[model samples]
Target: MALTSIIAIYALFWVMSAFVLLPFGIKTHDEAGLPKVPGQADSAPANFRPGRVLIRATIIAVVLTTLWVLNYTYGWIGVDAINIFEKPEHLKR
Candidate 1:
């Protein structure tokens, strides 16, 4: 059940990203300026930089992924609050 839920969440991410994010121009690369490669003409717009929307979306996705991982393994809010690495010697059975 847990594994299935995780898979579903990831599936939802792709679905949401395609239908939701792509519409608003949340592109992976620069829209106006193409990235410079070796021995290439600078044909793209020089004034353009990475979009703020993409950056914010990426950050939000990472944060949510971390939270999901924490919730799955420890059933907690965050990973830092749960000391899963600390051994409880009494449970050595």
Candidate 2:
């Protein structure tokens, strides 16, 4: 794959990882024994750490992207393997 394609794919994976990891490790004010400020939403996290979240998301994305790249390079699973409707020539006999 091209360099740009790899970068684009990685970026997509990073964004997806961020969203998937957002709710994890979160603590609402009530859960953390912190008093909520007036007008604060009930679901809002008491301690939001952007840096930590970003780091975790990056790690997750890297692992996923590495596996994806390896699969692409080695063809561990190919298009034919996923084509459920089509039978291989040998199997069609």
Evaluate all candidate structures by whole-model CA lDDT and list the values in order.
0.57, 0.90
CA RMSD, predictions in order: 11.9, 2.3
Model 1 residue runs over 4 Å out of place are 1-50, 77-93
lDDT for model 2: 0.90
TM-score of 2: 0.86
Q: List the residue pairs that clash in candidate 1.
A: none
Give the clashing pairs for model 2. none
Model 1 score (lDDT): 0.57
> Candidates' TM-scores?
0.33, 0.86
- lDDT tens per residue, model 1, 1-93: 377776677556645544455445333224555576666554444443346445655665666666777777777665565669876668876
Per-residue accuracy of model 2 over 1-93 as CA lDDT, tens digit each = 788878888899999999988888889999999998999899999888989989998998889888888899999999888998988789998
Best by lDDT: 2
